[model samples]
Target chain A: MSDLSPAALSPGGTIGILGGGQLGRMIALAAGPLGLDCHVFCPDPDSPAFRVAARHTVAEYTDTEALKAFAESVDVVTYEFENVPAETLELIAPHAPIRPGAKSLAVSQDRLSERRFLAEIGVPTAAHARVDGEDDIVAGLETTGAPAILKTRRFGYDGKGQTTVRDASDAERAFAAIGGQPAILEERIDFRIECSVVVARSEDGQAVVYDIAENRHENHILKISRVPADIEPRTAQEAAEIGIKTADALGHVGVVAVELFVVGSGDDERLIANEIAPRVHNSGHWTQDGTAASQFENHVRAVAGWPLVAPHRHFDVEMENLIGHDVDRWPDLVAEAGAHLHLYGKRDVRPGRKMGHVNRVRPRER
Target chain B: MSDLSPAALSPGGTIGILGGGQLGRMIALAAGPLGLDCHVFCPDPDSPAFRVAARHTVAEYTDTEALKAFAESVDVVTYEFENVPAETLELIAPHAPIRPGAKSLAVSQDRLSERRFLAEIGVPTAAHARVDGEDDIVAGLETTGAPAILKTRRFGYDGKGQTTVRDASDAERAFAAIGGQPAILEERIDFRIECSVVVARSEDGQAVVYDIAENRHENHILKISRVPADIEPRTAQEAAEIGIKTADALGHVGVVAVELFVVGSGDDERLIANEIAPRVHNSGHWTQDGTAASQFENHVRAVAGWPLVAPHRHFDVEMENLIGHDVDRWPDLVAEAGAHLHLYGKRDVRPGRKMGHVNRVRPRER
Candidate 1:
């Protein structure tokens, strides 16, 4: 792959975005001020990303003709999510460059592979084993022990496609729950807190990482994320190091979020790699208002072959996601002084849906 | 005019934007998020707004058929600037709803008329007199005196179409320079500071104002704006009142800005209405990143007939315009973590041109 100068690309160049969700919508929004045009491709007509894009193709990712047309029109291709198919990437790649490349998709698409890839790169992860059938499940439980999680190898998100195995007796039920798909069983390592580092890398290898973020989840959905993450500076540094190493290993370009479990006793803080999101993650939403350059803008910059902008913290920040009925509080949120509210312009507020978020900068005590 | 609820508008509904500039592009940008289409009617195809808008009519404002076609296709019409022609308003009025309506434009388009309207409504304004031509110039100066400003009644902006009549002889030259057009002579009252209030009102008569903005200008162009303008509580209240009263008098149904000059000494702080902008003003640009609800969103809400969102400030914000070559520092601005850089996506960087801006939020010091 080759790198292009930012100025050479100019503002009129088109960037292709896959997955027309709020993330894609935000990427398009961020791209606007940079003088870049975005073309969003998604099967759904109601995709939020479609609203802001200069052009959109309403076709399945598997539709090669439409995909070819989209790729030809754009200077480069990027995605808003990690679930992009290898074939879709292969189709787009021959026409225009795809960033965070297919290698990232291959590694992140499957749980077993991602863990194996992490271990191969000398990144610490939980003890894990693959389970193909009932017999394999028994062996995996024996090796990884009980109190481990059994997750399907692909298409799992927000705690979906996974089952918790607390005891040996839960093996069959867990196996049956996942419909006996190819799965991975990992030891449920105890961790004091869940933290993530959002890092962006340009094609030329320059990388920038935001401050570590501490995240809280409810029912497998993110609830709140605080930046500068109430953690030791060493832990934050290590988390960023892990993120950079992971990005380098995957030859990733564009923004990627690496979720980590900060574990162990005092003076022994260690981070275990949990997952690598090849695109901007929900936990990094704080960047929109709390930091100088947002993850969205940085992602656009990276994919456009621009220089990586160093992220800075404007204030200690807290971001809360508005889930389901939470969106109804927009009026109240709007009235609250010093609260930055962002609605995705999503009409349907279904259960577990991400409607919007609010970032409040905590004023430093004088 | 009748109001249309958010639910009443659909994806294909055309929105007619009155001016062809960066603000129109931004409004068009926001319109896409709501799934509403945009049709920009401006005489300049080279208009920056044309790049992002879906459709455009590049015809003279006086082209009745062009305006009619534009108005007929759109559900509602809004404007980027307050200087629309009376005939242009008449051309579209019977066809579609024009928001921040024609009445507001009539008052704001002419300096003398705006002052008269404000003064008639018992709103405080600097002492002034109308000057029809060079003959009345002397007498008008006699009433307002030296150090007054001689300004053409219409088509003036960024200090253009006007001159400072510092003395009697200067007043004569100023009158001749304006080609003796009808103009306004106003006493250049000493002001402590320049500030503006941005307010949005719905057709249902609900209105909300953002924090008072203290502004600084260089060469007639806004240079920087700070929110939570260091002012007494009473002055802030008065500023909001001025905005509300101005909006009400204009029968405005969209975002409006009331720029005022703070005069007088301690314990007697007084506000003198300077001008009315029937569209979003440059002083409100900080709201995009520093407020809970952006002025753009509020304007959309107002024109869409939705409930106006209450404006909320997130941080003490300073917005600095990236005028002309100032945008050359975008790399540094982008690298500065706390600065939110917004480039207008304009192609050229002419002197005195508003290329973009950066909003920096400083930590609230104790």
Candidate 2:
């Protein structure tokens, strides 16, 4: 086993966070209460996380001088997004320890590598084939068949850099739609629902999984997430096991969210791994109000090398995303009795942008 | 009704906070999720709240130019502490609305006035007499008797500015101990325990109170607060009712905590109002982890003129303050299961200084 006794961060230590989006803002907020300070590093001058952090550096991710200065200032390094460049990590790795590690980042950064890694760990995934050129797309189509998804291997999110193929004729068009990047064609699963398990693993390989979250998507963007997904206890247990196994396989020392597609009905229900997020996920936002400890706090704890607490749902919760114009309803939502609103301090509300979320929780039945 | 239709602040509006201590830091944190931005105003350059606020003004409270600029930058003004100078409020009152109002601040700032106001509203309090000189102190002792507590009428907190008089001859020594400031001599009550009710009131006079909290103090400083105070149902209800009444009486527009002393036994148990804090109290920190909505959020809602939510406790929570050296235990505390730690980003841990707090929550008994 890897050395379990990693150097734990002291209470007054500074945590270096990359990517100052909503996730980073929330993480910085969580770290404050634990006596840990945060230094947010993001390219955007108006990044939301900068408002809540003790210190921040605005520079390109690949700026070696800035990266080295930031790494030297903090006791440990963590990221809110998995898309951080490999070179950036390389430059800072020697200066500070990065939780969830470079390995987890490498796997999640590319669709092809993520699938291959999952398969190697014996985690069942959608039928997928790597696509490199026109010939590879044709061969990939022959293997995965029609009604498959063609997604760029890297830098794709919220349905960007992806397209659906219906037949052989659509293969070339799909490849062109994804900017002709190195890609993976995945067979679309006939599933009943989408769910995710967010787990946190400590340096010692100890892991704790939160309740499964049922997710709903609109235009390929997450719209809502409900906790205690309407699945059998056995299925839920299996999903948790998968999350823990994946986290262990990665040797990740922070939160990892494993999204899965649930197929079939009742006794035949099973989960197919879809993707892994190497940081806090939107689907786990309900934990902020419905559980004793939040996913953000757990992620902070893991990176700080503290023991993990398996948070249990104290309430049945529904978390609805306020995407773009959806945030205009903040007035009414704030007046709602059980609605807990959380808005990221973003200046503009472009279409499909994630502005905030509201969690409504009810006491769970005994 | 004093025009109950004051303009309510909309989301994205700026909130000007007068203190930049831990309380202000927490308030700023709570405001962020509600789509509101904070501009902390404090003289301390190292104020903890400055780290989280979107904007801040580091100038003396008496600086009219700075106060006016701060007032003009925000839609509403509020304070985390009651000690904000009257001149400072007057300078900013025309520029922005101040929640909890000047009346609440005027009363709570003086021990003599607070007691008189409570009596005016028919809220029972310890027998008290104002003392402006040695002659008044002698007369006050005659009326309140020995074992009375002599406290300054202004700026007293956490046991400072007060002394216990053991006998009539000890009055002069006790009075001198408190800097001979204008003070009040209060008859100390023989009580079983101390409890507090934290309530939030909106501009429209709508109010909501959280569950009562039982408090324990050391060296006159609050050390622990446990929710669902071990009291009779009727007593708890009565305490809550008194809190609402006090809030209404002061025309308070935000969170107000009324600390009470419990006397008698069983069915005969009753509470005597001891003090009224016009801002968030230390006792309500448990709500951060144990309730659907925290006191900080509710206070923000009230000051922002949003609808109030009467939060119910989901867990039995015990909040312990980390004073001075107590914060050194953070390494162990963060590893403890069910313990949620919150540290104010304060750099110094001077003796008796409030550095942070830990909330330990468990499933509440049905």
Instruction: Tell me, by lDDT, which candidate is best.
Output: 2
**What range of 10 consecutive residues in model 1 chain A has the weakest lDDT sum?**
A1-10
Instruction: Give the per-residue lDDT digits (tens) of candidate 2, residues B195-285.
Output: 9999999888888899999999999899999987889999999999999999999899999999999998798899999999999999999
Q: For every candidate, what is the interface RMSD in angstroms?
A: 6.6, 5.2
User: Which ten contiguous residues of candidate 2 chain B have the minimum total lDDT?
Assistant: B1-10
lDDT of each: 0.83, 0.89
lDDT of 1 by residue, A182-282 (tens): 99998888898898999998888889999899999899889999877867888888888989998899999999898899897468888899988999989
lDDT by residue for model 2 (A126-210), tens: 9888889767777887778788889999999888998998877787788889989999988989999999999999888889899
RMSD of 2: 2.5
Q: Chain A of candidate 1 scores what in TM-score? A: 0.96
Alpha-carbon runs more than 4 Å astray in model 2:
A1-6, B1-6
- Each candidate: RMSD: 4.8, 2.5
lDDT, candidate 2, residue A320?
Answer: 100
